[model samples]
Target: MLVIGTTEAAYMLGINCQRVRQLLAERRVKGAYKDGREWKIPLYKKMVDIIPGTRGPKGRWRHRLQARPTYIHVNKHIIDSNRNRRENQPVIKVDRAKHSKYCHEVEITGPCRVVYRPHQPLCSGAVLWIEVEQSTRVITKLYG
Candidate 1:
């Protein structure tokens, strides 16, 4: 029944004196009682268990467009124009209304180049252009 001060208890437990005071306030340390101006703890009693600190930031990680794979959005008018230009080309039609909150990743099997064009009066209202080599296949994946 050896009574020890908060600083001595903290030294024995390899923790800060403030942490010992906190444990005493929470009544987590066994056989520990508060005196007039200090906390007295038994030498044989164990300290409160320590919880592991969180590794990353405080909140959940946010999703960013640059972090994920690139995606392109094409409207119905663009698809119609592309179909008119190339008769034998296969056009993948994506519903703009249904996928308003999502982005589609277009994966081309062979050599391909993705071009982004800003809205201009001279050029057609197409924002994204995907140029693929001959005999290449394109696959589209949707992600919200």
Candidate 2:
């Protein structure tokens, strides 16, 4: 019988090293025995079993939200300044059909108008709006 340490046994069984020691102490592993300080496990023996629970797949433990493109409206002055900036930030695309719902939601009025734009590094189920003013530019709260 090929013998291996607790760490190797844990790796073979897809479990923690401490769990392998625990299993040894509990006498769960058929051919596992303690030699001095180290626990030796037989390679061919049935050492461990996966416990049933609510965990999903290996990589997809949590669900991710879907993202969609958004549009925003800005003043001519602000738009001009943005164009002149060095960063070359993403320009707000004008999509009347897509942004109609969000346009009414922001309630565009006065000298300032509301526009919608999809956030950079797109987030799930939400979008950002850039509210440009004469002296300052502000990013509005995320809306889902």
Candidate 3:
């Protein structure tokens, strides 16, 4: 399983470290443990993406961005792979106010990986991100 530190979990969860620990303790997040020096948790990159936000897959992360955006999505079947979907979609962080439709806080069965790429107002009618699924780790890229 992929393990992450408290800081990383907090960053992905879009909250402070304290909150992350609380979530872990409460079992809101699965596979979390307290290390001798600190707490560690199993963080699936995809989980963070489903958290309702406009920040593209990178900004949500506290640290640096990965070479390619990485995260998992449970709604893989829902994605229409027949057409040229978001496969080569570029990621950008966006403001929730800008794209309320996609930015709304929605509940998901599990965390699915998604990159936050805020679309430029000049580029289109709304500010949203292009989502794509990572089939394998080799093809997937972790954000921060």
Candidate 4:
């Protein structure tokens, strides 16, 4: 076990020299002692064994991104209208329900197929239907 200074410890730990000194003062780093003005920290086999500090709680920033629309409303008439449209088709937002009980507005885009007749004005628990096309390579691999 070789002994190193604060600068070398900071480099190995991927932290600033000031933070390393602060950790030494807080007695967080094990087997580290102050010799007059300089501090000598003992090198360990792994970085995890060098410092045993408790981590902070997980952040809630990712929860914001996970927040989705309560309802996903897909209309047959809207898809029919855009069937002949160009590549850059504008997404239409549904505000009022014409056939279903749900009236909460939600934006819907892309092609969709009706799997079941009862799944009108889809809610959180509803099964969504999205149309997809099989590529030439995938078709050959499966059926060729």
Candidate 5:
């Protein structure tokens, strides 16, 4: 008798945790018992061998599950309106040698490209740069 909880028993039996609890209530697993308030359900391999069904995953990867947030609790809403508007805007370019004529308060967006050269704003070999709001950065991860 391999004593275990309903959830563990469910995994060994290839069933569900709730179903294992049901079987325990029905006295299906001979040696199973509930000893604590919230938990303390136990089972054995012999009990699991008689149950039926399938396992979820073979521990090949990790899984993260979270409850869906209500619409009112959304963190950030990226309006697609600005994304398309940027396509029609004009591109701004200036020679690196002529950057002294430019101002820092310039509101630039859209298809602008920069030609980087020595003594220019770019410190790397990059010939182009873009300005974006520091707070608008968003990252996402998905599992399927």
Candidate 6:
């Protein structure tokens, strides 16, 4: 049986010399052994037998809950109001009991616009409003 040096084996296998030495050291290459400081590779039809494995450590979030917001709550309320002819009338009432279930109880200190659906009837004592005390900047990771 003929044998070849590390450099010749690396050239034939299309890999680097250090990698071939590593394969030899790990005993991954079949019929390959080390003699003194040099590695002797047996020249055969199929000599190299390096097994493939994961490159690095396993991920930590595979079976665990990832990072998420501390609080995530969404509430929606329907208003019931009467259709009366009035030139000027306050559409909103300060009745917090109707929407108490959906309220998160937060204070606002900045300018914000109130939004409501026109088709939906406003409740007799239903007040719905969302105020943002401060804007929050969120950075998200996008994966294709």
Q: After superposition, how far is residue 63 of candidate 1 from its true place, in Å?
A: 41
lDDT-based ranking, best first?
1, 4, 2, 6, 3, 5
Model 4: per-residue Cα lDDT at residue 136: 8
lDDT of 6 by residue, 40-62 (tens): 78755434444443576532211
Candidate 6 has an lDDT of 0.43
Once model 2 is optimally superposed onto the true structure by TM-score, how far is the C-alpha of residue 59 displaced, in angstroms? 19
lDDT of 3 by residue, 1-144 (tens): 677687655545445777666555666556666778776666565443223234435333333223333322222222344234645322332222122121112333333444445554323433333332222211222233
Q: Please say which candidate is ahead in TM-score: 1 or 6.
A: 6
Best by lDDT: 1
lDDT digits (tens) for residues 24-140 of candidate 1: 786767777778997777754333233233564442211111121323345565457757886333344322211322234556666767667675321335567555543243455
| RMSD of every prediction | 23.1, 20.2, 14.8, 19.0, 20.1, 24.9
Q: Model 5: how far is 91 from its true place, Å?
A: 39
The residue pairs in collision within model 5 are 4-43
Clashes of 5: 1
Instruction: Residues 14-92, candidate 5: write the lDDT tens digits.
Output: 4567766776666656555566744344434234433322565343211221122111111111224325564322222
- lDDT: the better of candidates 3 and 6: 6
Question: Candidate 4: misplaced stretches above 4 Å?
Answer: 46-49, 55-144
Among the numbered candidates, top TM-score falls to 4
Candidate 2, 1-144: lDDT as tens digits: 677787656544545678667657767676677899987776543333332234555421111111222335433444576567743333333332123221112332324444455654222222444333321212233233
Report the candidate with higher TM-score, 2 versus 3.
3
lDDT of each: 0.49, 0.44, 0.41, 0.45, 0.36, 0.43
Indicate the worst ten consecutive residues by lDDT in candidate 5: 68-77
Q: In model 1, how large is the Cα lDDT of residue 91?
A: 40
- For model 4, residues 56-131, the per-residue Cα lDDT tens digits are 7532111111122222335545466667663323332222222122222332343333345355624533344332
Q: Over the full model, what C-alpha lDDT does candidate 2 score relative to the true structure? A: 0.44
